[model samples]
Target: MGCLENLNYEILAKNCSFKETRDIVKRMCKERYEIPPGFKIVGKGVVGIPPIHVGIREEKLVCTYTKPCHGTFVILVDSPEDIEQVRKNGKPVK
Candidate 1:
């Protein structure tokens, strides 16, 4: 089985490194989404686009994922306001 096949989304959200998440996003994500106002960017997979892996909006966890032959996707997962790992590791916009 592939690495992603075994990877758990909740664990990935809580513990994976930025490099690991970025790699996954790059391979799967083919599209991007708009970052709404006041959201803090936690991880960006690729350049020049709206797609990202993690973010904080209104005290929630926003994550991006992709499905084979289905297209890239974004979602808001329930989480505490202080997931320090994701918050600290994210590459913020300049």
Candidate 2:
């Protein structure tokens, strides 16, 4: 999925990248609450937002399934503190 801004929570899913959202949906359809080893997918977000998929490997997310053509997967890895924490411990963002 993409990003969600100000909108009623009920209608947010209508705006996400369909393929990305669809893949995630399909995986969940096969089995509820499935996540990779040593990680967790959160069931909710701040305020009236939907569930979030955390602990995703940023490197792995930029693959052919999501892109389908030659392009870029822009990851804004801001914050030296956060980067350092991940580098040092491999801990997923909370």
Candidate 3:
């Protein structure tokens, strides 16, 4: 499997809908990385399932409007390694 670093967020934004992006990320994490069972489409691809249903700003992939996850939590991305640093922002993991 390829690394999440190779993902092209801009291309994914142009090619897929938000739901598609979310599904792809979840599936890839499960199949390729052995990380599964915990993922949701929060605002701005927020991961760890924040309680608030506050949808994030849908501005391309790396939406500036999306706020950080509640209290240092992480947003979902392509790679497990960068979940805390920089999320895939807007892109599919596959």
Ranking by lDDT: 1, 3, 2
lDDT of 1 by residue, 1-94 (tens): 1432333334223233435554554444333233332344233232223434455555555564444453444444454532354556555532
RMSD of each: 11.6, 12.9, 12.4
Candidate closer to the true structure by TM-score (higher is better), 2 or 3:
3
- How far does residue 70 in candidate 3 sit from its true spot (Å)? 29
Q: List the residue pairs that clash in candidate 1.
A: none
Clash list (residue pairs), candidate 2: none
Q: After superposing candidate 1, which stretches have Cα over 4 Å from the reference? A: 1-53
- The digit string of per-residue lDDT tens for model 3 on 1-94 reads 1332354333223334334444444432432221122333322233333221211223212211122432222123333333322233323233
- Which lDDT tens digits does candidate 2 get at residues 1-94? 2231221122213334434543444443322222233331112111211232312233122111123342212222223443233344442323
For lDDT, the strongest prediction is: 1
* lDDT of candidate model 1 versus the reference: 0.42
True-structure Cα RMSD, model 3 = 12.4
**Model 2: CA > 4 A from native:** 1-75, 91-94
Q: In candidate 1, what residue range of length 10 has the lowest lDDT sum?
A: 41-50
